[model samples]
Target chain A: MSYLTLSITLIFVIIPLILSKTFKLGLERDTIIAAVRSIIQLLAVGYVLQFVFNAENAVYIVLMLLLMIGAATQNARKKGASIKGITWKLIVTFLFIEILTQSILLGLDITPPTAQYVIPISGMVIGNSMVLGILFLNRFTAEMETRQNQTELILSLGGTPKQAVHTQLITSIKASTIPTIESQKTIGLVQLPGMMSGQIIAGADPVQAVLFQLLILFLLLTTAVTTSIMLGYLSYPTLFNQRMQFLRESLIRE
Target chain B: MTKAAIEFKDVDYTANGIHILKRITGFFPKGKITTLVGPSGAGKSSLFKLCNGLQTANSGQIYINNKLIEQYAPTVLRRTVGIALQEATMINGSVEKNLALPLTLKGEKLHKELAIELLKVVGLKESYMSRNTQELSGGQRQKLSIARTLVNKPQVLLLDEITSYLTVYPSRTSKN
Candidate 1:
């Protein structure tokens, strides 16, 4: 698309801003700022990705991947800041998902080992897993807070830390992954995911794009489950001390 | 005098910069019933938590059966000193499953007879075993909580205002 056509997309933002002002929603400023920020960010990323794709060097690709993981970790940690060492746990979980998914794709030759193919796929995987991590941590912490008495009762009855948080862990894992599962179930009926649409817009065969989208959807399911379960286990330990006592302060609202 | 079942020596516990219990020293003797009487917010529940491994004292030490509470592994310590909270949070299952939990954690066979007997001790009937705990009344749940704790046969039972939920206290409830 030409710059003029892209600028036309600003009409969408203008419509929202006007609607907000007319309705007295008080969201006009935020709406405008979000639109401007997205434009700048996406344009900047587009240029950087173009350079990295041109370089096609392993080091550049690795650096870009690391940058994505770092940003994703920082964003995801906001929901879980109550638990100690949450930042590192998020970093490890995101890194694990990125590496595991990319390695599987490259190792099995499911996708070619090229920046053009790897970068976008890695972005989707990392971004989705980050959201999944945030969902799991939020639900898990909420469960821990609400069920503090039950957890203490379990601990006081000779249960291990694993046993004490087992129910919450399972509940959080299921809760986080439900969106992914439900979205996948309704993929074709309700929405055409970005990857498939992007591929079709770029003149790829409809059948080929559908197959690739299927691959991504399945990989997302795996990443969602793996990230939630791993992060759940990792975060639960931080809620307690070495003395096996629940750190009540950790549950306090800051 | 018999050795104290549980002892707190200069125990201090603080939460959110507030001192809940400070410089507390006390003992509940073995083979004897000890009652802690105080107004609300007296930290009676906190003291029970310290007796087991649920909450550690901020300073000083707690002992169970004359051994430093911290010295025992949490699992062993908790098994020796079980606590029944006032709320009686029931597991999402039948009463039998809740009673069988302690045995399940210990990897022992669930004793059907003992479970029924414990229920009876806590003023519950044998028929309540298969009933879903969610369907139970508040008083029934409290009894089930006590019965569940007794299933582990903890030498030092910490009852944290558990009887407040019951309509009538059973004479056999404290025999252990």
Candidate 2:
């Protein structure tokens, strides 16, 4: 696509700006800022990706993946800052998801070992993990607060720390993963996914786009479940102390 | 005289810059009913919490069976001392499940006969075992809460405003 077509997309931005102003939804500023940020960020990433693709160096690919993981960890840590070592916990979860997905894609000869394939797929894996981490943390903390009495009752009954928080941990994990599972259930029917639609729009064959999308669908199912369960396990232990007392501090929202 | 199941010395507790418990020195003797009479905002619930090791005293030592409360393993201390708070909170399940939670935590299955027995002990009929806890009235829920605390046969029982709901707890005395 030419700069002309890219410029024409501003009309899409303009429509939201007009609608926001007319409805007095007070989202005009946010809409404009979002549009501006997307344009700048995507353009900058486009150039960076182009450079990395040409360099064809394994080091650059690793750096890009590290960069994505770092950003994801930083963003996800905010929601779980009260959790001990949450920064590393998020990094470990994201890294695990990235390595797990890439290894499968590579080991099976599913995708060529190229910067193009690795970087974009890593971005999706890390990005989804970050969102799942935030969802799990949010729900897990809320569950703890609402169920505080139940937890204490269990603890007062000789229940271990694990037993005290088991309900919250499992509830949060299932709650976070349900969205990903449900979304995939209606994928082709309710919506053409962004990656698949983008591939088709960029002139890839429909069949190839669908095949790639299916690969992503499966990878993300693994990503969603692992991210939630892994983070839940890592985080629950931190909510108790050596004496098996609930740390109450963990329930204090950041 | 009965032996004190729980004792507190110079216990001070503060929350949000407010001193709730200040230098409290007392003991709840075993094999006896100890009722702490106080109006709202008194430290009655906080005292119960401290006994169970659910919360520590800001500046005092607690003892259970003459051993420092902190020295005991948390699970062990909790198992020894069962407390039923005024605000009854039930797990999302049938009455039997809530009653058997202590046993479940111990990785032991609660027998159907015992579940019914405990239910009956708390003034609840055997039929109440299969009833959903969410369907219970406030009084029934409180009964279940107290019944659950008895599941482990905790040596020490601390009840907060229990009589406000029902005239039960004969078992705590009966067990002696």
Candidate 1 has a DockQ of 0.81
Model 1 chain A is weakest, by summed lDDT over 10 consecutive residues, at A76-85
User: All models: lDDT?
Assistant: 0.87, 0.86
Give the residue spans of candidate 1 off by over 4 A: B172-176
Task: Provide the lDDT at A3 for model 1.
Answer: 96
TM-scores (chain A) of the candidates: 0.98, 0.97
Candidate 1 local lDDT, A91-172, one digit each (tens): 8898888889988999998999999988999999999999998888889989999888878878878888888889999999
Poorly placed runs, candidate 2 (over 4 Å): A79-82, B167-176
- For candidate 1, what TM-score does chain B get against the true chain B? 0.94
lDDT of 1 at A102: 83
RMSD of each: 1.7, 2.3
True contacts kept of each: 0.88, 0.86
Worst 10 residues of 1 chain B by lDDT: B167-176
Residue lDDT tens for model 2, B1-176? 32788888899998767899989988888777777999898989989988888887789888888889988887888878888878878888998888888898888999888887777777788988889998998778888888889888888888777767654545553333
Per-residue lDDT over A78-162 for candidate 2, one digit per residue giving the tens place of the 0 to 100 score: 7554688888888888888888898889999999999999999888888888899999999998898888888877887888878
